[model samples]
Target: MFKFWYANQQNRVRWANSFSAEYRLECGVRQGGLSSPALFNLYMNNLIDELSRTGIGCHIDGVCINNISYADDMVLLSPSVRALRKLIDVCESYAATHGLKYNATKSELMVFKAGSKTYNTIPPVMLCGRPLNRVTNFKYLGHWVSDDLKDNADIERERRSLAVRCGMLAHRFTRCTTQVKVTLFKAYCQSFYTCSLWVNFTQRAYSGLRTQYNNTFRVLMGMPRFCSASGMFADADVDSFSTIMRKRSASMLRRFRDSPNTILGTLAERWDSPILGRWIRLHAVK
Candidate 1:
């Protein structure tokens, strides 16, 4: 897929008042001086190239559940654990060749259902969060299996977007030479101070649950939640900081055609190469 930097990482908040910058910058393209949005696709493409000669389509394998492949979490429809294990082998091999590590604990598999369709979902990871759910967040191919009541995640996202804009605006005003009383306002006005409260409240709750009520997390909170809190929200509950999966869409995988992270482009190429497909199926897929 044509992966773009997420909104959070794709920030254009003016950092310097002395120099008016573009309020909005499209990331992924190499631009001089701007480094907020790391061009992660460059690295992913390298991995794709390595796997293409291996003769594996990775996820193009068939998944059947209730007789339909369309699912909020279609990846979970692999029929049995053996199939999932095969998928994992493909993943490990891909990681090994690309000089990357797949954190298995975080790189787990979960199954969810909406109506009759099954979904496969991946929550966010620690340290460096991936966009498994958002354009900026690490979404597996930028999509996941989610349920109907999960609208709260979008609400949380809106709250976070507000905070980023407000934080940037507050910082801009504080640094502007033309803006009078910069010092006075910095010391007195708590304008930007409270902007992240919503972000914090949800984050704190997630943290609290992570340590004590992890098992009963959903029951305790009485609802499913996702964190879009900027770095401001630290120590969140396990899945609180993820974009849960939703109905699968071809559009979601459309970006895969050009993204650096395509398992198909890499593995399929390798599979098409003579001898590699036999090697993997005989040795790796055992």
Candidate 2:
């Protein structure tokens, strides 16, 4: 396997001079290539498997989930601070053995329920003998995740971002047709609100988001702020904001249900009661 990987990697070259000086890559996968992510995942799988054998991950319904990874980003979870530290040690050791190094500056430690008063009790975590900074909230994959898992802060941030984008769009596309404006709104503005897969929208949160959506449509249609948005929505032939969010949530749940033996599937199974109950309620209402 090592020989094959090295052989395939030898073809990678970069020019050091305008025409003649070429250097061959002897190690590390190429960045931004389509195959790089898969290759990296294959290399990291061994380390993850080793960690799994140590049984130091979060356990739920007899299933152990130590980490969730997508491409190179990973989120590690443990039930206790000691176990989390051990996992970090294992990761550092594995990286050293594999000719890789962890960027301690980019790493952060967060303890759930470790509020301001009790946060000091949680011990420090070190990478390369340097302590990692602790944070009360962190952004992961475009979503703001807080210790309490509340969506208020994240929602407000997204709302402001969307508002700015809408203003820019309206300014630049003033001469665009109504249909074109609608298309752009759906493509650009809607994605910011819908991309957060883990958001559990409460009534208040949904209402706020709905208002933003209406204001966006009103701006696109050149309608007065006080006018009813329903007419513009009907002209655009787009579903209501709540309906779109509900469909997205339901689609995500269905995908989780259909996936078997994976991390998400295991989570869905463990939370079967609430997930299934929601599904039933949704269908009944339909």
Worst lDDT run of 10 residues, candidate 1, spans 63-72
Candidate maximizing TM-score: 2
TM-score of 1: 0.28
lDDT of each: 0.35, 0.75
lDDT of 1: 0.35
Off by over 4 Å in 2: 1-27, 114-118, 193-206, 271-286
Stretches of model 1 off by over 4 angstroms after superposition: 1-81, 97-99, 116-149, 163-286
RMSD of every candidate to native, in Å, equals 19.5, 3.9
Ten-residue segment with the worst summed lDDT in candidate 2? Answer: 192-201
Q: Estimate, for each residue in 7-65, the C-alpha lDDT of model 1 and write its tens digit.
A: 43343445556545445554334355354234554545444343343343323433112
**Positional deviation of residue 284's Cα in model 1 after best superposition, in angstroms:** 52
lDDT of 2 by residue, 1-286 (tens): 8557656553434467445444556677777778787888898998888778778888877778898777678888998888988888888889999888888899888877743434555677788888988887898877788776557767877778878888988889989997898888888777655332534447686567679888987887688998866776777787766556567667767788798756777766664555455554555666
